[model samples]
Target chain A: MMRKTRFLAVFLMAVLTACAGAGHLSNWHDESMDFGAVKTVAVMPFANLTQLQQAGGRVRDTFMSMLMATGGVYVLPPGEVARGIARAGIADPTAPSSEEVVKLCGIVKADAVITGVVKEYGEVRAGATFGNIIALDMSMLEGQSGRVVWTASAEEGGVSMKDRLLGPSGKPINDITVQALNEIINKLFK
Target chain B: MRSSTSFLNRISVFLITSLLFLPGCASVKAGPAAAGPVVGANFRVAVYPVANLSGARAPLKETRRMLTEMLRAKGMAVLSDEELETFLARHRIRYLGGLSAEESEWMKGEMAVDAVLITSFEHYDEVFPPKIALTARLVSTGIKPVILWGGSSALAGDDSEGILALGLIEDPGRLLEKAVGGLSDSLTGYLSGKEERLKGASWRAVVRRGTEETGQGPPFYFTAEAEGGRVHIGPFGPKSYYEAPFLAPGKRYSIVVAPFLNASADRDAGDIVRLQFVAQLAAIKNISVVEPGVLREKMLTSRIIMLDSVSLADADLIFEGLNADLILTGKVEDYYDYQGPNGTPHVRFSVSLIERKGGRMVWTSDSSNTGDDRVVIFDFGKIRTAQGLASRMIRVIVEELFSGPLIQERPKGVS
Candidate 1:
């Protein structure tokens, strides 16, 4: 009886740890962002892998909102650089050329630019039944070097679509955004 | 007099040769194809999921062998087999998992993979209680797969077309072979459109009809080089227009680069623009899409709404690009009913319509019955009719968009 209880305890701990939190589970992989004496970070328009057009902008806003809210890193507002793109006539706003990224940095007046392609977003559906799944990818880069300091992608397959579809309006990927920040925020400072 | 006549004849011959050869060289060499600075000519391609059909797992050996053969047929120096394995290890996936556009760009920039193809497909049996129909769809990571024209078939084992057997039908292998052959044929047809043989660098384009000189329109006459793509002028036509070659999935790096250099040449590229727009709209149709293209076209034009579908991989790209007042995107998915022992009826269907925004989705109605699944076994026609599902999704979505910022009037010409 004592041995059985001990075995169960170890198994339970393993299961609990898996379900504990994003950081604990994510530490298996080295997903950290380091600014390395760089202060200002220009968050480029994140890629939109979803069907939604504004997804990239929202991701940009979320990163901006969360980071700016933290009062740690200086974020460059897209509105400030919209003019430069318009002037350069980059028809597709999201797909800024490397030259364009550099030019936009000049306008934003930032030391580094954080930009990456939005890897994915979608729902898990069984026929008409719904399953919640939301995913995002973010990368922070230095403006001058165009080198990525940190890159991370997150995907959530079991998002609990039942709750959102059944209950009131709610953001499905808010936790992803929060977790994304938490995953890299400290690493950048360090 | 004989010497003067001979001299005149020699001069005439010389004049003719120069006339033909000089202009040919000048026109061919004058085009922007020769103007742009050479960017990264040595393109490195990260052929992920090379051996797999879609992002999902499949029999690696057979499928990959076939896919590699196909790429080799295209003269693609795709990364060697070992390189593909290394890439898979780096990306942390067993297969390529179908890189998204952003991921493709990142790959091109980081790993120097000029292009990437992400794919997903399902090979399953649809049981209509007694009858079983087998189908497969090769979907791009983000866009709906181009049905390859022949992936869907109406034949079963025993080589008896349209006959559904009780047990696993006889000659199941041959039946699938026929289906795949048909599918490959269609994919070839679609891939033909992606061929940039006549693709050019000039910004100018014309929608030409057949001329009297040649009975058929768009006929080729001679061989010439246009931008990065090769142009063929057929023996049939006197007139042929110039165009930049279309971007084929298997080969895009060489094509995309030329356009980047002479930006003006591709600025008004109607083909690229139309295809990109179609890509945007096609996403909607693939994501649990049931409606005919007509309804989508009508609703799209009549509203300030931007619409499309997204796979799990590209949720971020779609989200970022679609920062309109409202955005609509979802996925195409299905479920299997494994009740019976070996004969589980696979009700194949695409169910998706989530990740909505603008605080819409005001209402939703669920209709998944316990037994009924993706394959409407008995109701064959009903199940195939996408309007039942796709349109309903649109109705909910349309109603939501029109609710607020998707307002019809633009605040009395604030402009």
Candidate 2:
């Protein structure tokens, strides 16, 4: 009976941990700036703080594709953005200053600039089960004033109930990344 | 004891019957049937090397051999593979998308071939329920080469799966044979003048997910809709334009399909999309697609690179170089193929047509599609390859652009 109680306790703890890591999202929008005015935007290279080498690039690409797919705005081609960055003489493409952002927008002929950061990406373990997790933050800056109009942060994926009960059958890393990006996109439009 | 023995006998009969009908579970859907030879039995044809755009290393030699066999089976003379290779090497000709007017005339003089067959292997999946897709076009070689016929075929292992999942194909080779065989039959039918156009595009347009209602918070340029729960921009939106209102019917127009800008993560996606457009546009009866190789060569020699859209200055250069009436260019947003049993292919791109004379934008279109767009129940109509899906999508776009008002016999008295 004592051993049975211990097993149940461990099982309960695992479930609780998974529930805690489910998903999170936070966003802030400035009503003063009209998002409709922003017809074209440039997505700069995302900053990667995680251990994964290409996590930043991967997440940024997904965000751009998903955002463009939304049909809400026209996302400039990466090659054109690169050329704009070079012409603008921006030393840091990943994290651009407000002045540099304005310069880039001018050269690319975009109304806005979008920057992103990949904080956490890859597998995370909760109890005995392992699953994919992706956490990211994104911001939109106006072209003329170079002021941030919208900001959002999102985290998705983790060990689920099914995963804890039955071995690891969680979603793939790509799916996790997409889910996280989708959450942030929803917040942007919201 | 007698009753028990009777039960055993009944069970045995049931088991034996099932074993007999097991093989019947697998089914085959024959493509367009082959008609009699209409290209005269003495016509000599050369099959070029199979273009691999599937993003996976395919069995090129084997596929060519099968195509050649199918062509010969229809009572047409096909140049040997070795001889074709030797000719290609001797001429140092690598571009296989389409032959130029000069090259076509030269081929008529040297090789004496009446037509050339260009084939592209778009998708070849080796996993369970193996899927294969390919496109073939026959262009005549003379003073000016014209696309005689074009056909595409795609097959998935579970396409014909009946109840109980009995008809699952595990062998990729069998799937390839069926796909190739169907294409051959379709080509033969077209050659015999029995099948004019293989099959019109019947797939529905990419739909927007209901969950993503255009956000009311901000005034946006166009309503955004997610096709298959994935974001897909304009073309279906309110401002999307179908055909070039300025296009004249029954008039042959020279077109140049420029390389698209790749916005997706996939490598060479722009090139792949460009070739697809070239192949389809060439098959249009009223349009003459310029040789892609010649255009690429000119672009290289002139050192012209398009940053985003084609500018007027660059347009003039293209006009002066090739006398092209319209320049077709766009950006490929996404071109991806999922793996495994439940994976689906996705493709998205937008195109624009620019007239060279005044350098004005005449037409623009956006397309997004998934393999499972129209698939319903038991995956009966699922497209398993990105190439198959893209071809279907492009076919619809092209047909809709040229159909109805654009190409209708300019009203009896209005011309």
On TM-score, the leading prediction is 2
Fnat of each prediction, in sequence: 0.00, 0.09
Worst 10 residues of 2 chain B by lDDT: B202-211
Which residues of candidate 1, in runs, are more than 4 Å off? Answer: A1-190, B1-47, B50-58, B74-79, B90-95, B100-103, B110-114, B121-183, B194-334, B337-358, B362-415
The alpha-carbon deviation from the true structure for residue A33 of candidate 1, after best TM-score superposition, in angstroms, is: 55
CA lDDT, every model vs. true structure: 0.34, 0.69
Model 1 chain B scores worst on lDDT over the 10 consecutive residues at B254-263
Per-residue lDDT of model 1, residues A86-171, tens digit only: 55565565555556666656665667666655555444444434443446555555566555556565554442434434642234
| Superposition error at B5 for model 1 (Å) | 81
lDDT leader:
2
Tell me how far the alpha carbon of residue B302 in candidate 2 is from the true structure, in angstroms, after superposition: 3.7
lDDT string for model 1 (B170-262, tens) is 443433444444433433333344311222211111111112234543222111111111111221111111111121222211100000000
Query: What's the lDDT for residue B91 in model 1?
Result: 65
